[model samples]
Target: MCIQTELQRFQTEFNQTLVQTFSQLPNDIAPKLHQAMEYSVSNGGKRLRPFLLQIMAKVLAIDPKLIQPAAVALECIHSYSLVHDDLPAMDDDDLRRGKPTCHIQFDEAHAILAGDALQTLAFELLINADVQTDIKLSWVKILAQASGYQGMCGGQSLDLEAENKSVGLESLANIHSLKTGALLKAAVSMGCAAQRNLSDEQKQKFERFAELIGLAFQIQDDILDVTATTDALGKPQGSDQKSNKSTYPSLLGLTGAVHKAEQVFQSALEQIEDLPYNTQPLMDFAQFIIKRQH
Candidate 1:
């Protein structure tokens, strides 16, 4: 099947799972809080992090059922991050996925609580997963580290600190690697961890692939911020420039950033070349990451 067709199939199945899971939430919860959580999670986007996790599970020959909870948990964390990231104290954005942002649609306090609830709900889903204890523990650790101070949160702090201040390429890369790359890498890592007999070497290779693509993904995002229209991005174009935050395009010129993205993308492809499993899907995903308009 074509890559686009395959992605659509995965996305459709994933969406059903998400809806089903959300529907199971207890009616006792505060109605507005529940609605806000549902709205944020249901807001449309590519669902790339969960897609990466699911695709890696396929490559590793892990059962989709065994990994489904993890996929959902990853997405919850991603969505929660977006909710918090768009707050008045943060990016102060008014739109997401072409719709009013959580804070805009709801009040700031509710959006904050909704983000908190979604974050806790992520771990709750993982704890209730039917997978074995070790795998569950591993997933928890991977996700917490990726989302916590050592990873995404730390990256966000660095990014905020760098605003209106000139930062070098290395500093900018470090910021993005933690801010954007950590969770993406964790998605791949969690999928690999699902394989009972995965070797250290195999795990390392998959991780390297994730790291390269994560960097490329950020570079492509930076490129698109300058090139794509607001309609295409479904968010403000030039927001990065407006915020005066350092980015790949800011450090490297636009031409240089594009070149860098391609270079990293090719490196990611090479990482999967010698793996025992068929890596065509992963390669296609890497292509999509670098080539995507938004």
Candidate 2:
């Protein structure tokens, strides 16, 4: 199937599964908190992390059901990060997914609680998944490392520290590698783990692919911040530039940033071509990262 067609089909199926799973969360004691959690997650973005996992599952010929929990867990973590990222202390974004951010829609305290709950819910889903205990344990460790100080959170800290400061391209890459690339890399790892068996060489190849794609994804986001409209982005466009934060465009210039993204895209395609399985979905995803309007 064509890339867009396959992606659209997967997006619809994943959305249905996600909504159904959220509906199953209990709401007996803290209805308001539950509502806030739902509100935060219901403002869906591209669902890219989970889609990466599901695409890997498809490539490996694993049953999609086997990876559903992991996919949901990954998305939960991603959404929680967004919730916290949009907080007044963070990016201070007032809008997300074309609606008010969680902190604005509800309250700051509730938004914080919702982010916390969603993070924990991610681990809960992983631990309770039907996979073998050892596999689940491995995945939990991978995800924890990805989301903790060494991964996304650490990256955020670096980003906060680097704000309004002159940072080199290496520093910017490091910041994005942790803050954005870690979870995406983990998504691919979790997908690989869900597969029956994969060689060390194969896993390394996938890791390389994820790393390249993660950087490319962030670069594309930086590009979009400059190129896309607020309505198209669902959040304030040019916020990064407004905040004076270091981005690819800020450091490399818009044309240079576009060139860098293209380089990464080409590298990703090379990685995909080396894989044993059909890699059309992965190639399409890589292209989507650079080519998407928002």
> Quick one: best TM-score, which candidate?
1
Displacement of the residue 163 alpha carbon in candidate 2, Å:
0.7
Off by over 4 Å in 2: none
Query: Per-model C-alpha lDDT, please?
Result: 0.92, 0.89
lDDT of 1 by residue, 1-294 (tens): 876788788889988998998889974669999989988998886889999998998888899889999999999999999999999999999999799999999999999999999999999999999999999999999999999999998998999999999999888889989999999999999998899787899899999999899999999999999999999999999999999988888888999999999999999999989998999989999998799877
**Candidate 2 lDDT over residue span 16-36, tens digit each:** 887887788877779999999
In TM-score terms, candidate 1 sits at 0.98
When summed lDDT is taken over every stretch of 10 residues in candidate 2, the lowest stretch is 1-10
Backbone clashes, candidate 2: 0
CA lDDT for candidate 2: 0.89
Scored by lDDT, model 1 comes in at: 0.92
